[model samples]
Target: MEIFAIQGYVDLVVFVVLLAVKLFAFINSLLWSAESYEAAGKLTKPAWTIILGIGVLLQFIGILFILSIAFTIAAFVYLADVRPALAGLRRR
Candidate 1:
Protein backbone atom coordinates (compact mmCIF):
# COMPACT_ATOMS: atom_id res chain seq x y z
CA MET A 1 0.00 0.00 0.00
CA GLU A 2 1.06 3.58 -0.59
CA ILE A 3 2.49 5.19 2.53
CA PHE A 4 -0.11 7.95 2.32
CA ALA A 5 -2.91 5.40 2.16
CA ILE A 6 -1.48 3.54 5.13
CA GLN A 7 -1.17 6.75 7.12
CA GLY A 8 -4.72 7.73 6.27
CA TYR A 9 -6.04 4.43 7.51
CA VAL A 10 -4.08 4.77 10.68
CA ASP A 11 -5.48 8.23 11.28
CA LEU A 12 -9.00 6.99 10.71
CA VAL A 13 -8.54 4.25 13.26
CA VAL A 14 -7.15 6.68 15.78
CA PHE A 15 -10.05 9.03 15.25
CA VAL A 16 -12.64 6.32 15.71
CA VAL A 17 -10.99 4.89 18.79
CA LEU A 18 -10.62 8.27 20.43
CA LEU A 19 -14.20 9.15 19.65
CA ALA A 20 -15.39 5.94 21.26
CA VAL A 21 -13.19 6.45 24.29
CA LYS A 22 -14.45 9.94 24.93
CA LEU A 23 -18.05 8.97 24.30
CA PHE A 24 -17.83 6.10 26.72
CA ALA A 25 -16.29 8.30 29.35
CA PHE A 26 -18.96 10.94 28.93
CA ILE A 27 -21.75 8.41 29.12
CA ASN A 28 -20.24 6.69 32.10
CA SER A 29 -19.97 9.98 33.91
CA LEU A 30 -23.74 10.30 33.69
CA LEU A 31 -24.16 7.25 35.87
CA TRP A 32 -22.27 8.88 38.70
CA SER A 33 -23.22 11.83 40.85
CA ALA A 34 -20.99 14.77 41.65
CA GLU A 35 -20.47 13.28 45.08
CA SER A 36 -19.43 10.04 43.50
CA TYR A 37 -16.61 11.76 41.68
CA GLU A 38 -15.43 13.41 44.84
CA ALA A 39 -15.83 10.29 46.94
CA ALA A 40 -14.01 8.36 44.28
CA GLY A 41 -11.15 10.88 44.55
CA LYS A 42 -11.40 11.77 40.90
CA LEU A 43 -11.81 15.07 39.10
CA THR A 44 -15.15 16.75 39.68
CA LYS A 45 -18.00 15.23 37.71
CA PRO A 46 -18.78 18.31 35.61
CA ALA A 47 -15.17 19.00 34.90
CA TRP A 48 -14.58 15.47 33.68
CA THR A 49 -17.72 15.55 31.59
CA ILE A 50 -16.71 18.73 29.86
CA ILE A 51 -13.23 17.38 29.26
CA LEU A 52 -14.57 14.23 27.67
CA GLY A 53 -17.10 16.15 25.60
CA ILE A 54 -14.43 18.50 24.29
CA GLY A 55 -12.23 15.57 23.44
CA VAL A 56 -15.03 14.18 21.32
CA LEU A 57 -15.56 17.50 19.56
CA LEU A 58 -11.88 17.95 18.83
CA GLN A 59 -11.82 14.68 16.94
CA PHE A 60 -13.84 16.33 14.13
CA ILE A 61 -11.63 19.36 13.77
CA GLY A 62 -9.23 18.37 11.01
CA ILE A 63 -5.67 17.48 12.04
CA LEU A 64 -5.85 19.09 15.46
CA PHE A 65 -8.06 16.26 16.60
CA ILE A 66 -5.06 14.15 17.47
CA LEU A 67 -4.06 16.60 20.15
CA SER A 68 -7.35 15.95 21.87
CA ILE A 69 -6.02 12.58 22.88
CA ALA A 70 -4.18 14.41 25.59
CA PHE A 71 -7.53 14.96 27.28
CA THR A 72 -8.35 11.28 26.80
CA ILE A 73 -5.51 10.42 29.11
CA ALA A 74 -7.38 11.99 32.00
CA ALA A 75 -10.75 10.63 30.94
CA PHE A 76 -9.37 7.15 30.57
CA VAL A 77 -7.59 7.45 33.88
CA TYR A 78 -10.90 8.17 35.50
CA LEU A 79 -12.58 5.38 33.63
CA ALA A 80 -9.86 2.82 34.15
CA ASP A 81 -8.51 3.75 37.56
CA VAL A 82 -10.95 6.02 39.34
CA ARG A 83 -14.27 4.66 38.20
CA PRO A 84 -13.48 1.21 39.48
CA ALA A 85 -12.49 2.61 42.81
CA LEU A 86 -15.73 4.56 42.91
CA ALA A 87 -17.71 1.44 42.10
CA GLY A 88 -16.02 -0.38 44.88
CA LEU A 89 -16.83 2.43 47.27
CA ARG A 90 -20.49 2.40 46.28
CA ARG A 91 -20.65 -1.27 47.00
CA ARG A 92 -19.40 -0.73 50.53
Candidate 2:
Protein backbone atom coordinates (compact mmCIF):
# COMPACT_ATOMS: atom_id res chain seq x y z
CA MET A 1 0.00 0.00 0.00
CA GLU A 2 1.02 3.62 -0.45
CA ILE A 3 0.75 4.25 3.28
CA PHE A 4 3.10 1.38 4.03
CA ALA A 5 5.69 2.75 1.65
CA ILE A 6 5.52 6.13 3.29
CA GLN A 7 5.83 4.56 6.72
CA GLY A 8 8.97 2.73 5.66
CA TYR A 9 10.59 5.96 4.59
CA VAL A 10 9.53 7.56 7.84
CA ASP A 11 11.06 4.73 9.79
CA LEU A 12 14.35 5.05 7.90
CA VAL A 13 14.48 8.75 8.59
CA VAL A 14 13.91 8.19 12.28
CA PHE A 15 16.60 5.53 12.38
CA VAL A 16 19.15 7.79 10.71
CA VAL A 17 18.36 10.63 13.07
CA LEU A 18 18.70 8.42 16.08
CA LEU A 19 21.97 7.04 14.74
CA ALA A 20 23.35 10.54 14.37
CA VAL A 21 22.40 11.33 17.93
CA LYS A 22 24.10 8.21 19.15
CA LEU A 23 27.28 8.99 17.23
CA PHE A 24 27.40 12.52 18.56
CA ALA A 25 26.89 11.36 22.11
CA PHE A 26 29.56 8.71 21.71
CA ILE A 27 32.12 11.15 20.35
CA ASN A 28 31.44 13.63 23.11
CA SER A 29 31.69 10.93 25.70
CA LEU A 30 35.09 9.95 24.39
CA LEU A 31 36.27 13.54 24.39
CA TRP A 32 35.09 14.28 27.92
CA SER A 33 37.16 13.27 30.91
CA ALA A 34 36.12 11.17 33.88
CA GLU A 35 36.30 14.13 36.24
CA SER A 36 34.06 16.12 33.96
CA TYR A 37 31.60 13.26 33.90
CA GLU A 38 31.73 12.98 37.67
CA ALA A 39 31.31 16.71 38.12
CA ALA A 40 28.32 16.39 35.81
CA GLY A 41 26.94 13.80 38.27
CA LYS A 42 27.87 10.90 36.02
CA LEU A 43 29.84 8.23 37.80
CA THR A 44 30.95 6.06 34.89
CA LYS A 45 32.22 7.72 31.75
CA PRO A 46 33.69 4.55 30.32
CA ALA A 47 30.40 2.71 30.66
CA TRP A 48 28.48 5.33 28.74
CA THR A 49 31.23 5.66 26.17
CA ILE A 50 31.24 1.93 25.53
CA ILE A 51 27.48 1.78 25.42
CA LEU A 52 27.16 4.48 22.81
CA GLY A 53 30.12 3.13 20.85
CA ILE A 54 28.54 -0.28 20.59
CA GLY A 55 25.17 1.25 19.82
CA VAL A 56 26.66 3.06 16.83
CA LEU A 57 28.46 -0.01 15.57
CA LEU A 58 25.29 -2.05 15.86
CA GLN A 59 23.30 0.57 14.00
CA PHE A 60 25.84 0.44 11.21
CA ILE A 61 25.34 -3.32 11.12
CA GLY A 62 21.58 -2.74 10.78
CA ILE A 63 20.65 -4.95 13.71
CA LEU A 64 19.01 -2.28 15.78
CA PHE A 65 15.56 -2.89 17.15
CA ILE A 66 15.85 -3.58 20.87
CA LEU A 67 19.51 -2.61 21.13
CA SER A 68 18.86 0.65 19.38
CA ILE A 69 15.97 1.60 21.62
CA ALA A 70 17.86 0.78 24.78
CA PHE A 71 21.07 2.56 23.80
CA THR A 72 19.20 5.47 22.28
CA ILE A 73 17.49 6.08 25.59
CA ALA A 74 20.82 5.97 27.34
CA ALA A 75 22.48 8.27 24.80
CA PHE A 76 19.68 10.82 24.87
CA VAL A 77 19.57 10.82 28.62
CA TYR A 78 23.28 11.58 28.68
CA LEU A 79 22.95 14.22 25.98
CA ALA A 80 19.84 16.00 27.25
CA ASP A 81 20.20 15.52 30.97
CA VAL A 82 23.86 15.05 31.83
CA ARG A 83 25.38 17.30 29.17
CA PRO A 84 23.23 20.23 30.25
CA ALA A 85 24.37 19.82 33.80
CA LEU A 86 27.97 19.69 32.65
CA ALA A 87 27.57 22.77 30.51
CA GLY A 88 26.05 24.65 33.42
CA LEU A 89 29.02 23.82 35.59
CA ARG A 90 31.45 24.92 32.91
CA ARG A 91 29.78 28.31 32.55
CA ARG A 92 30.66 29.10 36.16
lDDT score, candidate 1, position 87: 89
Model 1 C-alpha RMSD to native: 2.0
Q: Please, what are the lDDT tens digits per residue for candidate 1 over residues 1-92?
A: 69999999998998788778777877887788999888877788888888877776776564464577587786688788877977898889
Q: Which candidate should be chosen as best, given TM-score against the real structure?
A: 2
How far out, in Å, is residue 19 in model 1? 1.0
After superposition, candidate 1 runs with Cα above 4 Å error: 63-67
Error of 2 at 89 (Å): 2.3
Top lDDT hit: 2
**TM-score for each predicted model, relative to the true structure:** 0.81, 0.85
- Give the TM-score comparing model 2 with the true structure, all chains together: 0.85
Q: Residue 88's C-alpha lDDT in candidate 1?
A: 91
Q: Against the true structure, what is every candidate's RMSD?
A: 2.0, 1.6
Which residue window of length 10 is worst by lDDT in model 1? 60-69
